[model samples]
Target: MAWIFALTIDPVAADSADADFADTFAVIDPAAPALSVGELSTQRGDGIFESIGVVDGHAQEVTAHLERLAHSARICDLPAPHLGQWRQAVEMAAAASGPGESVIKLILSRGVEHGPAPTAWVTVATASDFTAVRRDGIRVVTLDRGYALDVPARAPWLLLGAKTLSYAVNMAAIREAKRRGADDAIFTTSDGFVLEAPTASLILRRGDTFVTPAPNGGILHGTTQLSLFAHLEQRGYATAYETVPVADLSTADAAWLVSSVRLAAPITAVDRAAMPVDAELTASINEYLLSPRD
Candidate 1:
């Protein structure tokens, strides 16, 4: 089952001190038509979005996701999202979720051409059971992302750092990975630096230290990764953000791809080369992820 809500927003009044949000949204029938054919999100993928993991009706890492949404808006030049209104929408979506795992997505799109404001909505739906992949782990292959590590610094207009609606390349990379006999793909810069997985963030574990690629290199900062790092740190594990070289992947003691909905999936193999997996640690990490979190 799924639920959708169309948000009523006034772009010009986005930052107004007296902006009203009491009736800012309305529930919509998922099967019925809600968006226009001229919507930029569908036509040109001109927008930004964030997916929040929901466990037992509780939306996790909402603050982090909202922050990223605003960041994307600034990058895309879309109207700044009213965080308070979006938070209410999240609460409403979470309330509609079942007791099991689910996903809540928030989308703010460039509305119809020459339209007054942007198009925004929230959707809640049941998530697929990822027990097997999360437990047994996934096979991964590295793919070049066709840009140097300095692309974000050099080409800000590419919108590489923003979590925009444009995902053709991302989906194609995953398809290419599958064709190469792998479950997923980890993107690497043309200069041979590790970036991130198509839909997840990469975390490499070396001894007791945990490292993820720095977000400065056009990486969408992972909310789950941040939360897990906090959990790991509280448990006495050192964490750092650094520019990870592709060669470092093979030498890592362990690795996992972390994301919002999928949580943490240990990488069993990269480029068909076997990587170590710590089952006990993976289970513990997933346990913490499955719990209700703010």
Candidate 2:
């Protein structure tokens, strides 16, 4: 399928005469060159981003996603985003994308080397076909993240909790899992505590209690996970953030890899070890997740 890609740039960042606006917002062609050769984001991967799910012309959880983006920018020492401008940009892209399920990415990168300002843009594109994967579930494998659980607190320079543009290692980890014949990879500390998935958060259910690794352990605070937990709590399910051992996957009644795009995907197997699949629970959680909430 030919994906529809559109870029909405902040008008203040571009010369007024060089840009065009749709509803007072410019949507640039993806094929057009948009960045400088020395853009630090492309050069050294210095930036932060947010991928938000767009459903029926609405950006899901906009406030949470934007807040997290700001937090990440702070960690990277990048200038704070102009939220009004960003909202307009996102609105521009979402309007152009025409309400079909899509992924709206808000990106902020340090501009060209030694440049005075940052580069910001919004892109709306087709979301991946995770429907089948979400319904059928996936198999995952655990891999060592090499960092100890306490590294975030001790070595803040690592920017462990920030969602930076530097995701090559994350991409490679998933590729490694695919090479091993698994659908996804769950990262664990060398000391044996389950952290999170390459691009998602981990959730393990033992009976009625749902547990995941504490965010203080150097993992990004998952926006989807947080929302789902609120719904689960309202539905009378328990949730916790605790140190999860790798072995907990085997003992848990169910496990899920949750994220913005994938939502709640149940893990069918861990390290090729099969687990009980609760079609009922999966359906219920997904129903609640997909339902509109004010």
Candidate 3:
């Protein structure tokens, strides 16, 4: 959280598409040639990955990071990567990446030597800029479903906590939002419980406390959102978990679409309704980020 500021992916990068990293690397997808990791194979299936923030040449929250890495691997049943070398992979990509502050992504596919596997994978992605909806605030639309409010309580066997690469559904929602003249889709369950954004967490503020749909709402344990909450708690802002509906989101005093990339991005509009993007909430987030990290 201390690593973020405003509704931005920090500073923008010089270019996004062909952004370079400090180190020589392999851009591997099953459809193309991948960097050789000592014959790790490139013929098998798919895998899952993460995209973490890189600030001042350091990966923010490295501990929660590795845990996420493992979480994804477990989700897809891929073998765990070598810790030391894999971490260096992130550092290598960060160093070799393009100009200005950046966010990095690492794609790790389960290449070759397998029976029944995922098609391919991306381990991580890092870049300074994010595909946020706007500059001042975001314009989001409510999704068709509600938060899976019973994930933890009802279906403990589900991949509720895992980060999966099967993102076609989420991608479709973004397109749908665009069709509706909105930025991104906020997914919910059928019963209408607000869960998360296209790729971020939904953080809404009540009177004083910042509330988010509980993890049981069927949201991934957002690395950025949680880390930011840690900092906010230290700053005396109570962060509570609650079941939020789209109607409630449209009326919050302040709200932001948060994630590891865009630290605390404000949401100016939810669907067609306009809402206030509280200055105090923004200030609190900035103060939290610019402060200090544990």
Candidate models: Cα lDDT each: 0.90, 0.82, 0.61
RMSD of each: 1.6, 3.6, 9.1
Candidate 3 wrongly placed segments (more than 4 Å)? 1-32, 35-45, 113-135, 146-148, 151-158, 283-294
> Which 10-residue span in candidate 2 carries the lowest summed lDDT?
11-20
Q: Distance (Å) between predicted and true CA of 66, model 1?
A: 0.5
- For candidate 1, which ten residues in a row score worst on lDDT? 4-13
Q: Compared with the true structure, what per-residue lDDT tens digits does model 3 show for residues 70-186? A: 776676566664444445456555554434344555455555343333222223333545433324777888877533566545775555556655666779899999999987778
**What residue runs in model 1 are displaced by over 4 Å at the alpha carbon?**
1-12, 18-20
Q: Which has the higher lDDT value, candidate number 2 or candidate number 3? A: 2
lDDT of 1 by residue, 1-294 (tens): 455333343343446564456566777776678889889999999999999999988999999999999999999998888787788788888888868988998999999988877888888888889999899999999999999999999999999889999999999999999999999999999999999999999999999999999999999999999999999999999999999999999999999999988989999999999999999999999999999788
Decide which is better by TM-score, 2 or 3. Answer: 2
Off by over 4 Å in 2: 1-5, 11-25
Q: Please provide TM-scores, in order, for all candidate models, with all chains considered together.
A: 0.96, 0.92, 0.74
Whose lDDT is greatest here? 1
TM-score sort, best first: 1, 2, 3
